[model samples]
Target: MSTTLSKSYYHATSSVSLSAVTTRDLLDSVAKKTPEKEAYIFPVEKVRLTFEELQRQVCTLGTGLLSIGLKRGDTLGIISSCAPEYIMVQLAAAYIGVVLARFHVGLPNSLLKSALLKSECVALVVGANNDDVYNQLELILPDLKTSHAETLQTDEKSKLQRIITNVEASQGRWKSIYDIMNLCKKDSENGKQRLEETSKMVEFGDPYTIFYTSGSTGPLKGTLHSHMAIQNIYMMCADRYEWTNDDILLSACSSLSHATSEMSHIAPLILGMTSVILSPGAKIHDNVSVIQNEHCTVLFSTYPGLYNLLHHGKINEYDCSSLRYVMTSASTIPTDVIQKVSSIFQAKVLHTYGSSEALFVSGRDITADEKEIIDKVGRPFGHTEVKIVNEYGKIVPINTQGELLIRSNFLFRYYIHDEDKTKQVMSVDGWYTSGDLAKIDRNGYIKIAGRSQDVIMKGGKTMYYASLVESLLSHPNVKAAYIVPVPDEELQEDFCACVSLIGDTSISSDDLKDFYKANIGIPAYIPKYVMVFDDFPEMLTGKMDQKMLTLEVFTRLGLNKEWLVHGRKA
Candidate 1:
């Protein structure tokens, strides 16, 4: 089919049927259908939970939460790694209709406090192994140092209880998961009744979970999603990938805090597939060993994680023939890396496009021709509608880059406690402005250019750093490339290319600049300053930290605010 240019709007041709079932109900149904099936495996912790065992733990913990005065609409904050306890708390929170607020383990104390306070979480769950959590909790709750501070009283009398897992000690007001379970076991009859009633009350439209953005560029915002929206989005993902009950999925990119965790961990439980949760701080060899030992068939991680696995020299020592697909996203995938993944794993590489607001948007399978895999992000998701619009909000022609707008049933409900931020991105008509510059091809595939904020202006032309970086990555010696804007006298902004080369490649900055000028064929697009780095700063979510890199570049180059205001000569 030829591409059509009708306001640059395109809707997905395929759609999957969805059910009006809550996440709790879905899990129960799966447990009932396959009671003996393996649901979760934590190799690092040596923990395994079958479908029936998982449901039992969820029900017990959910009852314990309700016993501690947590009710529907109350929020439970989880700051932990990818462990069995984390999954238990998450499922229990969802089962009891409590809003699960996931806090990344890497978040600073200031952001962590802001997230918990803003979300008004009634309870906090932390893993004992996470030293940051212990350190931050002392600052957040000063009373903890005095004695066992069971609860923090708010104006509304919504007391916040602290629960810590994997430790036998319940010092200071912190309660252990074992203690909570014991409390529920002591009143098993009452807990069971309360759990059953609470589960029955939950509906598909109820708020399920809140995930905060990485906040690498701005303040963290908690994005909320309803049970129906998240569940169906994952269902669609499973359908798109044709995931089967026998498939074992491994998540190496993030823990429970990230959106990808839900796709790799939670969704697989409902589908009766095995989910292997790797512990944090796992190395490249650990990942490969998990896949080999677990006989994992599906792998979901960020581009860096996949890239590491592809180059981990010892990967060939493992029996990875069971792997069927390696799904990665969150940043640009180098063309060579994509090819290497396929060649090494003999599996399809899916380059997906998604965000905290919109769960799963579009994905391209790298098993296709090299050019198509490198150039496009696949078609619109089964139930998503995407469009490209210019500054005037008018539809742009096909293949013309503009800000992307998406309308999807799976879009987040709103930013918790931030109506102004919610209104900034969401329109009354249901369209969510992505703030990403992208273009749609005639054949309906979408290609992301770069964030609108990242566009560098040179002279009178707009230059997208992503395109330039992609070209630089195509060079054999270049391992990774990042483009940042620098103040210029003649041009509005000059380009600064920060690159890391393959081990001891002997490729210099001048050599890369010459290669770019020869290949890109744009004199202005060639970056004026080329900086070489052994490594780039990365955010918790595994994406390169562009904001930090830019700041560092300015500081190192002795560029000041005066230079930005009145060109570099100032």
Candidate 2:
């Protein structure tokens, strides 16, 4: 045998194949075939766009961005809800390989400033859908109110040079998004050349999006994902879920700032599935009518919203039988809830397990027998490698609780601009350390046994226990505070600020509200409900008995029935 390996040996080394495609490539290919097919439907705005229309919008915006000097690899931040304009900016930026840093329209000053600085965005795009964007941005960029339409020159330290807006405000403050779109069209000479050059420079390996999530024991982490990463996940998910071009997908909950946005927005856009986007300010009840009217094939989020809708029999008023399946990964659903939801919709309940690190890990399809899906997160995808490892980094045996390690090409490239955080979570060999506690059985099904991180999934947003607790403890009137998850009918979970005040400081609920109004405006932290505790319960091991304390809190809040029906703190 020769020292060098043969062609067969080289091929056998790896079973996975890389996808050589970008979001732009997929959209272009789909639009070419389905030129007149409906690609997006914005019910609230009464807007419907075909494949060609949407493609033209994306290209126009991409060219306008190029005209404004935001080229390939430049960071472009967006602050808006999941409106039609927001989608346009997202796709347009991706079209020319501009990295997008999606900011939640509801984000407070504290979080937004940090994210903006860390992302180092060259330009920020503001959407007209939400009014909060103005108030929030004005706090960070003091010059936002005074800067002319040309470029932003602020006292804040970052790469920010321009502020673009789709909304009408004071004239010289920002550049109109509409004006920018028409800027290149206004100059046809340079526009064509820049568009061709920019499109050609776009590569499959370019970083497409930065999805920020709450850190386990630290600050917010922005997960950088490549075009290849996003494309692979969409391709794999569509194949696995048996999605077809005829499927009409709607993101019933959350927005593009979420990790699931890739599947909801980009997947449907590129894969020929009709994307039904709701305008900003749509209430929880809007989904019911949308599903009834559009005959949406799939509902893309949630736990409590659907549960409450069905539990109260409100869904009976609508003909939503067109739904083929409801996909959710916001949090684990109890077995009883899964069965109830499936029956209510007459569709399969697909419970997924995913995170910012590893886009899609595993999922459970509700079966007739409870044993099949009970406490199980199903098997890993074909491209994924999973193992339950102990504290010592050794692989544990089947059915043993340990940290779940995920290895896949679909995993995020890294934590954006943070090498230390990236190295902390990922191993040199490419294993991602997921803090979740899980177990693998002989049948190859994985069961989640809780997790190490004190994370609360409120509605569809991720809130860290440490961040809120620290904010609470920092108050002059507070001594100790513990943030606990409370169940609700609307929001999947709510936060209860259980606090033990410092001596002689008599701060009532109103005082807490006032404090939150001044210091913490994030709804996830300063919730509507607050509870004052004498002290938190402790275990024999001298540590806080979080489980017992949570139960006590629930009982006191008169929410005992919430946990009994769910069976456990999932």
Reference-based TM-score of each model: 0.94, 0.77
The best candidate by lDDT is: 1
Candidate 2: give its CA RMSD in angstroms: 12.3
Stretches of candidate 2 exceeding 4 Å from the true structure: 1-17, 168-172, 215-217, 311-313, 365-370, 453-570
lDDT of 1 at 107: 74
Clashing pairs counted in every model: 4, 0
Candidate 2 global CA lDDT score = 0.74
Looking at candidate 2, the ten consecutive residues that score lowest on lDDT are 5-14
Instruction: State the local distance difference test value for candidate 1.
Output: 0.79
What is the TM-score (0 to 1) of candidate 2? 0.77
Question: How much lDDT does each candidate structure score?
Answer: 0.79, 0.74
Itemize residue pairs with steric clashes in candidate 2. Answer: none
lDDT of 1 by residue, 1-570 (tens): 234655578987555687688868878889999999889988888999999999888888888888888899889888887478788888888998999998888777777777878888877887867765666676766654455446654344334655555433334356666667677988889889998998899999999999888775479999999998888888877877888898899988655688877886666555889898887767778888888899999888878777667666378888889999988865466767877887888988887888899888888643355576565677666788999999999999988989999998899999998999999999999999988889988767788887877777788677687887876676778888898789877786787889998777787778887888788766887888888898898777666787789888888888775655465321
State how far residue 336 of model 2 sits from its true place (Å): 1.7
